[model samples]
Target: MSDTEGVEAEVAGAEAYAEAVDVLGPFNGPVLLAPVTHNPNNGVTDGVWDVTAGDRAAVLKVLTRSKGTTGHWAASDDPRHWNYWRREADVHVSGLAQLWRPYGIRAPRLLACVERPDGDVALWLERVRGGPGTRWTVRQHVEHLRRLGVAQGAVGETADRPWLSRRFLREYIAGMTPGQELLDDDEAWRQPLVREHFPAGLRHDMVRLHHDRDWFLQIMESLPRAFCHLDMWPANVRSDGPGSALFDWAFAGDGALGEDLGNYLPDSVFDLFVPAARLPRYAAAAYEAYLHGLRESGWKGDEHLVRLAVCASAVKYDWLTGMMLARAGEAQVDYGGDRPVSPELRYRERGSTLAFLAGWASEARDLAPRLGFPEAPSGR
Candidate 1:
């Protein structure tokens, strides 16, 4: 038989095949289950599976956290206050996705959810059939961003949910600041591989952002805040028949006006789902689309501030890349999907990621004259 048949046969024979059997009941036939590709984040060991249960095919997201795992803003590994998994379950159960169905945004149907006392949960969700946002073209990505902006722009503001992390960007970036694990790992930057990975035009700015803890916090917080899919990357989004579906609500909360695009613009390339060279094209498209969406949704806001926010928000990579450098022991920068740099996941894609991060710096520096934020001379 062909390779496809061989893999199917292997999947049929493997005992790993029957994970949620107890939870999902007997399938209509031999259950076809395979691991869904996802990036590893700060919190848990996630086993997101695609299972064909009888006539129905669904996604089984198995979330687990160990005693040693810690919880932070977006890293909701801890079950108690930082209920990332529970929040997602609640979002589906509460019919929040339906509210956005008209806005071209949607979430998967929650089929079954099992929560144990030990802070572990298993979510069986409807395998939203269609293309993932990662596969969308630059124009598609822009349209989706516009729809997202209109959707979120319409949301305006509201009373805070206690479950929502109040200062998400603040807390998420805190751990990687000076005197933190990120700066402590700066010595690793001395390595030629790690050093060479970044462009010379960017090295000083990258380091500046790393140590300038106060600026990152200040600018991100000062922007026009709104409810957003804090994690707006392609992997967490999918394109439905004519609509779109966004998943992974763990990071859905208040964010800068255009912060989601910051995630979207860079990540479309960072995930290596989009061609690296086209990243700038995607970034420009997404930016204009998002602004158009905001305007269409009746947002009477300052374009300059929004632009500044988008640029500053790009600093999201400051801590992330530093973490990769710190953790990358004397190894070749293969640019594969490993924890520290796993988000980029491809050698060819690394430059795009670095350029995007640097773009944020340069753009932000250019916007500072308009933003009126404090001046820290960027050694251009």
Candidate 2:
């Protein structure tokens, strides 16, 4: 199949430049639309662009889909799979984006938008000029967490919006059973790197989690829910601005308290965007800052529940760990042609990622007893 078939290419228009001017109103100079790739580790759901209209520059994003990416995903696994294609447009047009903008939980400003009769979407968004999220220092990340807590917490569960993220974990995993997919092939984890890196207790913890995920998922739902930037990894965030500038609202939704930081704490290292050693300080900074922000936003829920929710939410990545270990040797990271990541380095990185995931799973198991949730019997 050609590259243009998926949702990302749906708006690869011959007249995207003209459409931008026509929809957004007159500009002094000719508008040119150039296709570009922004951060797409999640999925290529949008055809992004750098649009130059005379002297003024802006970005044009057109939502697109490719079955190659979605071939494994069943609509039943995530009912919103089709509907979320228009989530960004929904956020802007619904005025929820505007509601969160001033609290410093801003996204790129929306200039204009269009909804095609065929159910496609195009957005004219302000080009945010800032540094990527990976470069932020611990203090900076703490403040980012603080501002994120305040901004999103300010909205809390009070946004009264139905389209906000719901069942994000199930929706995101599509149809793959992370535990079944991994445990079915124990030999895959026997690969040298995983065998060497995965801790014994953690492995035992993960196996038990596979069979008893429902209770843990229930625990996650019990926590106070609010709007969460579901894809808050370093690649999807920028910290160069005075505060955080979030993007990619496709995965934005109702999530348990502290869930975004669950991903935030481990992903920079998981993707090897930053060194693994920094994770401790980064996580420390994030939790404290977020709690402070939660209070700043007047959240009065039990702090202990938030802490429990953080570890419980690790359920989201249970399958991801197994899947990563099962497929151990794919060259997943692209270096923008600057340099190739040596296979040994990649192997080590993946091993480290598995180890980190194991720790989170173990935390879930360990935290359960404390939270009065029964521990699942070990599969070992």
Candidate 3:
């Protein structure tokens, strides 16, 4: 009836076609179609296969171009745009998959890649051996964070200058700005909370915090560079029994040792906004665990620095929510959520989070003194 309906019908038919034939390769006859299911995790398009050929009953995956609304920046076949989602999928399925194998990192094994007649690319991958609903407990999350730290450090040990650098931050800051109109309505309710509590200045120095070129360089040079999973959140990762494995290598690149760990902490814990009830205690435990893991992994950098970075990371997202709200009037697909976070709520939560960081930073100031680690000497 419509474009959306047409796409959905095509997808449904494709699912049927995928199921009809044996999709697993090393086949007898011409391998045609395979049974495939749509992955629920990604708003983007992905194809999952349940293979019946092998005795072990393996799974396969094919990442495809998503047939989404034509506004947002996403992976597409368009040559005019910079991002080629299908091609990037191929690089990840091919390059990073092999690079991390020796380090005991768990991820799907790349099987093969194919190009369809329509000039689209598909990546065939070994199904990560797990099911849905593998909810992560705090301890499990800690363990996963440690593994991510390990991955970062391991990559850092050999490689140099991983991808999450000052350049990346500056680009992120510039690119993240959305239309000002999106922030006009509901933000009136929320913007005050942020402005009242947190530091909201647009000075060169503040934006510089988003991309401390020197800081990024120092962190990269100071730490061992290993295979860093740029997006190391829960959805992109899974646990198979006792071991944890990460998927989604689309953002994998070289970077600092603790960068991955720092990224993982805030992201995994605060999916949207941290509930006020769970802030202090949860943050304390998570911070302690991170510090302990870092020390064990031979990290010599100040844990406080990592903490600062993580705190700053939260603010960046808060800014992002504001930017997205500024675009709400448009008919674009709202990936943030459908419930509609008013600008007031966004500002309040962000302000509270910033207040929390300032409080933590204050404690950090006194912490060194209490521990008798060192003190700022009075020169004047």
TM-score of each: 0.80, 0.83, 0.60
TM-score (C-alpha, index-matched) for candidate 1: 0.80
lDDT of 3 by residue, 15-90 (tens): 3234324345343322232443232334234544444433323444555565452434444454222333553364
2 or 3, greater by TM-score: 2
On residues 227-299, what C-alpha lDDT tens digit does candidate 2 reach at each position? Answer: 7777777666665357667776766667887888777776666656666666666677788888888899887
- Top candidate (TM-score): 2
Candidate 2 regions with alpha-carbon error over 4 angstroms? 1-13, 23-30, 38-46, 65-69, 72-83, 178-186, 196-202, 335-340, 372-379
Q: Would you list the rank order by TM-score, best first?
A: 2, 1, 3
lDDT of each: 0.65, 0.64, 0.45
Q: Residue 75 deviation, candidate 3, in Å? A: 3.6
lDDT by residue (1-380, candidate 1, tens digit) is 00011223214333334545664666666767666656444454455667765675677665665424453423453333333545666556666545566778888877777775666677777777677676677778889889987877787554566555456676666565432354445566565555655555444556676666567668878788887667777877777877788877765666788888877777667556687777776778888888898899898888888788788886677776665565545333312233244422343366557766776767776776666777645453
Query: In candidate 3, which residue ranges exceed 4 Å CA deviation?
Result: 1-72, 76-95, 98-104, 129-134, 157-166, 179-226, 269-276, 298-315, 324-380
285 Cα displacement, candidate 3 (Å):
3.0
Report how far residue 188 has shifted in candidate 2, in Å. 1.4
lDDT of 1: 0.65
lDDT comparing candidate 2 with the true structure: 0.64
* lDDT ranking, high to low: 1, 2, 3
Q: Tell me how many clashing residue pairs each candidate has.
A: 1, 10, 20
